[model samples]
Target chain A: MLKRTPLHDWHVAHGARMVEFAGWEMPVQYTSVVEEHNAVRTAVGLFDVSHMGEIRVRGRGALPLLQHLVTNDVSRLSPARALYTPMCREDGGTLDDLLIYHLGEDDYLAVVNAANTERDLAWFRAHAEGAGDVDVLDETDRWALFAVQGPRAEEVLQPLVEADLKRLRYYHCIPGTSLAGVSGAIVARTGYTGEDGFECYLPAGAVHEAWEAVWGRVQALNGRLCGLGARDTLRLEAALPLYGHELTETINPLEARLGAFVKLEKGPFIGREALAAAKAEGPRRRLCGLRLLERGIPRAGYAVHRASAGGPDGSWEAEPCGYVTSGTFAPYLHQPIALALVGGGAAPGERMAVDIRGRLVPAEVVPLPFYKRGAAAPGS
Target chain B: MEFPQDLKYTEEHEWVRASRDLAVVGITDYAQSELGDVVYVELPAVGARVKKGASFGVVESVKSVSDLFAPVSGEVVRVNGALADHPEKVNEDPYGEGWMIEIRMDDPSELEDLLSAAEYAARVE
Candidate 1:
């Protein structure tokens, strides 16, 4: 049976075209992806992200257990602070990428991908065997997640929560009561889109009322109701990695260009050996951004080829350099951009080809993010 | 909702305007609204023979890709080339400037199988 969020009926009433995604019925779009994408980039947009899995780890050994299990250091996180990290296997392969929130001295909430909830839980259970004083509990069914993202997200959300939204630093979170009467909720200043935003995790029963209340506030502030389609495009433009595409069981966190999150010097960890070896030997492939030089857009799984550097007769020679993992016609850049796993030598400014519809389309390697941050000027 | 009484529609949301031996094809307003903003269109070349109910083109929106099926068997005589650059025309004027293709009908009697405006609207609802 497919699971439904507390706000499922609300989405239906709002005319959302629902589709089965990650074993749950979710809205793919409300109006248009371009419009919603622009809304989040220019103003503010609300999203129902209740499908994400939230797991709570509690006990005295929670911090040490988490530090040993994930790639990031849990000791660095204070109360109400969050860190984005990838949980990897002993072989340095990413099991799941998630955000770890330090709620208190003995309590931490780990938000993981909905599809990987079971796997992540099993992984955590297996690793927590010898670690006494740690108990991992899946709290997904108990919580409803909502995100308000973009320039004016704070303004739209400030009136709904009692917490001082302006004083909250990025990646910090606090427990508060929703204006709609949802209590004991965690409101975190973090988001997938490269915008100033907050993600609220509220009680399941109060989710519907909170969603309506937040929606009313955002609508009053001229924010929009965005869906998964625009969510994907916006994150792609920001160069954020998605699981099962940019992240995989075979793809290590370091090779995914997320070394900043991997704390190798913190102490001994599960994947530290393999990660250190990889660091010493160097990665065979690197993830980079690709900008389409031609009119066609490159899609995921499309072959990326490097034109021959030296050959006689001036004949064009090609070799499979890599493949595109995530791609889209960037609405913000007004051009097609992609994230490709290419060879070491295929650095930025290099020329490449993406095979689309049996035709080789020219593309150029560019920097990680196709779009850059400017002033936080909200649109009226 | 504003389907012209003179036009005919199919269950697949395709609208057909029969003018004797020629037929102008487009999607219903419901289809355009459901598709949202169109970004690209891949139409068959002129003179290409198309079978009834066969895919003759594809329309890509920001979210999904939808196949455009031929409502009746005919030879493609013309296409709306303006959609290549301005695919939003499909969203702006689905029945007029947004017409997908014009076909020289091989069997004009096939129009009898399509639903009238009222019938089509009721079926969609």
Candidate 2:
């Protein structure tokens, strides 16, 4: 049986195509995937991300426990700031990549991937290491997360929320705010779509009113009731990593191109030593962007190889250099783009090809972010 | 979008408009809508031979990819050139402007195996 969000019935009523994702029956799209994707790029969109897991760690030892678990430096985060980090096993394999929100000196919330909720919680419990001051609570069922993302996110959220939308900086959150007449909501200026947006976390019981209110303004602006499909495209265009595909249990942070988030010198963490050793050795196979220069779209698990014409059956005889982690015809770029784990001397501008189905389609390695925004507003 | 009674369809959702030995082929409206926005399409060459029920092409959206099956066994005589530049035509009008290919039928008897519009509607519904 699939789990249903509070918005499941609403999504179905609005013509959303629902699909089972990560054990939840979530909306994949409404009218179409491309329409929802483009709406987020050019205008605005609302996402019912209620399936994401929320785990709370509060106590005097919260800071120490967080410091020992994640790859990034958690001590640097002041209250209201959010830190993005990779929580890893002792051997440097990623457990999950999550955003840690500092609510107070002793209160912190780690928002994790929905599919990894149980495993991540178990991992946290296993690593508690007799920290009696820290108390970990699974608070996922208590909140509904709605991400109002895109260029006009501020305009759409300002009227509905009590807090000053413009005052919130990127990666900061304001607790004790009221949203759409629902009090005790947490409005955070954070999103995965690489847009100026806000994610609202309110009581699940009061979420329907907020969603309806947000949907009203969104419809007036010709915005979209988006789903996981648009969310994937938006993140792909921005070169953001998804957990299962980009940062997996075997892929270290360095290999996944998350070097910026790893604080190797930050004392002792569960995976710090292994991460440092891997960093010193240099990543052998790196995750990089690939643009299809010829026809055919690259799909996940497709073999990527150095260009060769030796094969007889109209395919490459060369062994695969690597494989694609994620690929799509980017709706924003209007071109086929992919992110691949490439090695064996494959670098940007080096010739390569993705074995799409049975045919060898030419491609070239490129820089990350198939699309880039022009400018960002202050504190937005 | 209406499925015309003049065309025949496959369980895989491709539609064929047969006229003697030559016929035009495209996906049904249900197929295109299910596919979402068409970002890219990969089709067989003009001279390529295709067997019924075999995958002759690929249709890609921003989210996923679906294989395009040949509705009838034939040799491809013409291919849709517009799809290279404007693949969204498939979603815009799967019947009229989005026709994928025209083939010289090698076995007209295979047409009898296709589903009628009513049958196709029932299957889709």
Candidate 3:
């Protein structure tokens, strides 16, 4: 049976096309993805991200337990600050990528992917066995998340919430009473779209009211209700890695070019030993951005190839180098772009070919983030 | 919403407009709206023989890919190659400019089994 969020009726009422995503019935789009994507890029957009898992870890050992499970050093996070980190297995493969919010001295919340909730909680429980007073609770069903993202996101959200959103820096969050009447929603001044935005975590029952309030405010500012399709495109434009596509069980954090999150010097995490070794000896395959040289858009699972040596039969026949992990027609860049996992030789400016529908489309290895809007950067 | 009573439809959301032994095949307006923006369309080659209820081609949007099923067993007389360059026409006008293929119907009587516009709309709901 498919689960439904509190705003499922709201989505249906708003003409949202609903689909089963991660066991929950969610809206894939309200309008066109291109229009919604452009809305978030240029104006403002809201997303129903209630499907994402919110796991709370609290007690005296919550800090140490989180530090041990994730690649990032959680010790550095001051109260109400958040850190984007990758949770790895004992073999250094990524279990999932999550955002760790240090809510208080003994409280921390890990927002993980919906599909990986059970696996992540299992990992935490197993690893955090000996840790002091640690409690890992899956609070996914208890809350509803809404993301207001874009340049004018703050302007739309500020009127409804009492929190001083301007004072809340990027990656910082605060607990506040909802103006929509949900008392204890956590408003985080962080977003995946690489735009100025806020992610609100409110009580599940009160989500409809909160959504109505936010939507009204957004409509007043000419904001849009975006869907998962636009959410994926916007994040891809920002070069933010999707958990399953960019960072998977088969992919290491270092190879995904997220080494900044991996603190090898930090003591005794689940994948600490293997990660340390990977850091010492560089990764075999590295993820890089690709800009298509031809008309075709490069898509995920398309083989990356280089021209083979020798005669026309071999020379003209491209040799498979790697594969594209994610690709999209970047609305912001107005060009086809992709994230490819290629060999070490595939450096920036290097030429390659992406196999699209049995044809090799020429592409160039480009720098990460095919489009960057304003001053937003990774970890900013 | 704008179901032309003259047209016949399949459970798979394909619309068929028959003219003697020649039939025009396209997706319904409901299918187009559900699929969102159609980015690329793969059509069966001209002269290719297709079977009723078989996969004939694919229609890809920005979000998902859907198979185009043949409503009647026939030989492909012509394909709308214009869709290769401009697939969004399907979303704009699925029954008109978005007609996927023209088929030389193998059995014109098969159209009798298909649902009329009202029946198809009822089935979808």
> For each candidate, what TM-score against the reference?
0.91, 0.95, 0.89
Give one digit per residue, the lDDT tens place, for model 2 in B1-125.
68999999999999999999987999999999888888888888999999999999988877778999998888999999999999999999999889999999998989999999999999888
lDDT of 3 by residue, A1-380 (tens): 99888889889999898888888999889999888988887789999999999999999989888888888999889998999999999999999999988888799889999889988889888877887698989899998999999999889878777778889899999865665666888999889997889899998988887888889988888889998888998999888999889989989999999999998887888898988898888888899999888666678898999754458564555788899999976766766789988877467887788998777888888887777777333333
Best by lDDT: 2
Cα lDDT tens digits, model 1, B18-116, are: 898999999989998888877777788999999889988887776666889899998999999998778889998999999999999998999999999
| Superposition error at A312 for model 1 (Å) | 11
Please list the residue runs of candidate 3 whose C-alpha ends up more than 4 Å from where it truly belongs after superposition. A177-181, A293-299, A308-315, A331-335, A374-380, B20-22, B44-56, B70-81, B104-115
Runs off by more than 4 Å, candidate 2: A308-319, A344-346, A375-380
Error of 1 at A187 (Å): 1.4
lDDT of each: 0.87, 0.89, 0.87
Worst 10 residues of 3 chain A by lDDT: A371-380
Which one is best on DockQ?
Answer: 2
State the lDDT at A366 in candidate 2. 87
Residue pairs that clash (backbone atoms under 3 angstroms), model 2: none
Position A238, candidate 3: lDDT: 86
* Model 2's DockQ score: 0.78
lDDT of 1 by residue, A334-373 (tens): 6778999887746788888898766788888898777665
Alpha-carbon error at A376 in model 2, in Å?
Answer: 13
